[model samples]
Target chain A: MSEIVLSMKGVEKVFGAFRALGPLDLDLRAGERLGIIGPNGSGKTTLINCITGVYRPDRGSIHFQGRDISHIEAHRRARLGISRSFQIPRPFNGMTVLENLLVPLDYCHIDGSKEERARSVLTSVGLAGRISHPSESLSQLELRKLELARALVGDPKVLIADEAMAGLSEGEIDEVLAILLALNRSGVAVIMIEHIMHAVMRFSERIVCFETGRLIASGTSAEIAENPLVRRVYFGE
Target chain B: MFSIDILLNAIVTGILLGSVYASLALGLAITFGILHIPNIAHPTLVVAGAFFVYTLAQWGLDPIVAAVIGLVPFYVLGLALYLFYSRVFERRGGANVLQSLTLFFGLSLVVEILLVLSFGSELKSVNVSYIGSSLKFGALTVPYRLLIPALLGPVMIAAVWLYLSRTNSGTAIRAVAHEERALSIAGLDPAAVKRHAFGIATATAVVAGAALIMIGPVEPFGGRFQIGRVFAIVVLAGMGSIPGNLVIAIVIGVAEALVASYLNPSWSPGVAFAILLLGLAFRPQGLFGAAR
Candidate 1:
């Protein structure tokens, strides 16, 4: 019902002899919360990589904000407002928390002072107190927060968070979920690829399940929970 | 027994020598330390820069003035080299260590051969008014050549350090080595950052070349002898630590001077490696670098 911010048509990604993902189609609407789930190596990462321009899909095309971006470079895609957080936090270890945010802000050429913007992002992520702390010194929770802050600093239109809550405690999971939810509420379309079932279910407005590079089911959370194909592939019934 | 005056003079000379060493190693600090490019051909490039300066000196230009003028073309050459390297190696999932080493080694040989063919195998030196002068301070004598080149190192280092610490492009360069994807996802092209960095690295070679020829005559293959010492300086300085490069270079220079004066002059060449081996064994993160 909403405007399509990102659309993928017949996308396929092959790794030598293996088909890593696609020969399928997907779309993300503007200001929508879409959740994707699959078991280990189920092409979830491949899909995200395709959309973020990390991997050039072997076939088909991707359109973002009505412009074809399948052949665009990853950084240019980011400048066009496509940003993501890695499954494992990959903060620039040599930099401070403030410096980490500054990289994206500076690269994106965002308006206003970089320090003020970095400080504001840090503050939003509840990391205002540790602005000058080196990224290597952060705890697990803070590292996760810093990763999110780095992604958010770009002012991305579409934020693909890949397993961002992995390895966190229930409380930490809740915290990150809240951040993503707040970000979505601010009109940014979010694609959450998470293994935390309860968190994804609670955050997603709609859910899509992937199995071996194909979308097996797409529906509301309740319909997906009741879908037999999703149960079989996700729960291995 | 070593006289107090002799010891003082050796230390002072060592410091001066170390400063020049820092200039030579600055490019490596960027290419190897920051960009993680194992450009073993860096010293060869410095020799090329020296030769370029030498040719220009014939036209009545000061070596330093020629070096400053030469930064532009050398930077463009660096960009082209990085592009060539990335296209051949980095673009296809990155080159392994041995492959990159081999490529750079071959490139160095090519550069040396070119230098030989063009300039002949004979030694070349830059003739400047200050070349034959020295500033005497009591028992200590600082040659104008050594003092001039030595001063260039700290000035360059300070300027580069400020650029790295206080600028956005500089921060992106530092971050590129750590997580290139982080840079990309932040809307900056990682390859472009590396290309720029490589250009900066190569540009430093011009000034360093000027400094080298100021110290003494340079032959086509003069860079070969410096390979080990320069690498030792970069690694011992904690990879990308710009300030650390100067300090470690000075330390190695002083140690080498001490060996030449109190120990054996023949043993002076081994000082860098000895310190490098010790640093790797004891503090692999380097003197100023944090644990990886």
Candidate 2:
């Protein structure tokens, strides 16, 4: 019943003869933390790729804020407030942490004074003192923080975090979850593509499951846990 | 034995000689260093830039001013060139690095051939009041020709440094070289960033061209001779470090001058490669590059 912010209608994607994802329909409402879970090749990334304009879906259209954004380029989509983090951590290896933050501040033109805004954002992501350190030297956890900081710098209306916590330790996962929670609380809608069940359940109010590029189930965390299809897809009884 | 006079003269001349080398390599430092384009044809573009200066010089404009004026058109040309390259190669999931190399190589040839057809393969030089003068301070005698071109290096380096560090567009150029995807997340089109960067790189070619013609004569095929030398400067400076290139260019210039004066002039061409190999052996990322 909440105002829908993004609508994906009958979206389909294929790579050559292989159907990678979709012919699926989904909607994301304002201020919702929706967790998308799927097995390794169940097209979770592919779906995000389409929505973020990394790939042009073969069939159907994506409506963002009531605009048909199917043919828009990825960067344009980002400019329009849709941003995605890659599954693998990708900080600019050749820049310092501070320089990395300045890149987004400058590129997005979010604020007039780049230096002041970059410093503020670095502090917001708990990277205030490490600004001058080289990005390649960042620890795994630090890298994840930098990745999140990168997504947040654009002041995106919708943030698609594709496995942002993957490869982090349990404690680091909690740290990132806290950051996501904080971001959601700031009124940004988030689509978390995660394989970690407990974390997803803890973070998501609603959940969606995918199997072979098809949406298998969508419901509250408790209802999804009770669904028979969700059980068979996971436990394969 | 090296006399005090010879030593002083060699050092002074080395500084002058380094300035010319810096001018020649400036465009490459931006193109290959900043953009990671591996634009082997950069020196050729500088040569082309020199020819443009020559044309305007014949029209009686100051060569330096001519080069500055040429920047806008060259920037636009660079943008078009990058767009074409992206459309043909990068858009197709990036045809292996070597494939891109071959494309640039072919492009270099086409440009060289076109230059030959248009300019008739004749070596051309610029004429100015300072072109034939020299400055003397005690035992040191510096040719005005050397002094003029030498001065261009530092001034241009400072200007480029300011642009790269103090401007918003400058940061975008540096970012594109490091992590292109980061640009997308920042709400900028990666293609546009690259195109703008390519334009900046090409703009340098005109300045370098002015310096080249001021120092000596240039022909269409002259770029081939500078290919290795320019690349060495860019790599030794570290990719995208604009101010760093000035220092490395000077060092290589002094080394080449020393080699030509004491060892053998014929061996000057090898100085860039030797220094490049040694620089890679010690700090592969370059003198100023971030350790990755």
Candidate 2 lDDT score relative to the true structure: 0.84
* lDDT for each residue of candidate 1 in B1-292, tens digit (9 for 90 to 100): 9698889989999999999999999999999999989999999999999999999999999999999999999999999999999999988889999999999999999999999999999999998997789999999988998999999899988988899888888999999999998788888999999999999999999999999998999998999999999999999889999999999999999999999999899999999999999988999898877787
**Which residues of candidate 2, in runs, are more than 4 Å off?**
A107-112
Which pairs clash (backbone N, Cα, C closer than 3 Å) in model 1? A11-A23
Candidate 2 residue-wise lDDT, A76-167, digit = tens: 88878887777777887666887777776665655477676777767877888888898888987788788888888878889998888888
Top candidate (TM-score): 1
What are the TM values for chain B, all candidates? 0.99, 0.96
TM-score of every model? 0.98, 0.94
Number of clashes found in candidate 2:
1
Kindly list the per-residue Cα lDDT of model 2 for residues B88-196, writing each as its tens digit.
9888887576877787788889989999999998899999986798888888888877788789878887888788776767777777787777677667777888888
lDDT of 1 by residue, A1-237 (tens): 889999999999999999989887999999999999888888999998899888999999999999999999999999999989999899997889999988887766667888999999899989999999999999989999999999999799999998899999999998999899889989999999999898899999999998889888999999999999999987777
TM-score of 2: 0.94
Q: Residue A103 deviation, candidate 2, in Å?
A: 2.4
Q: How many collisions per candidate?
A: 1, 1
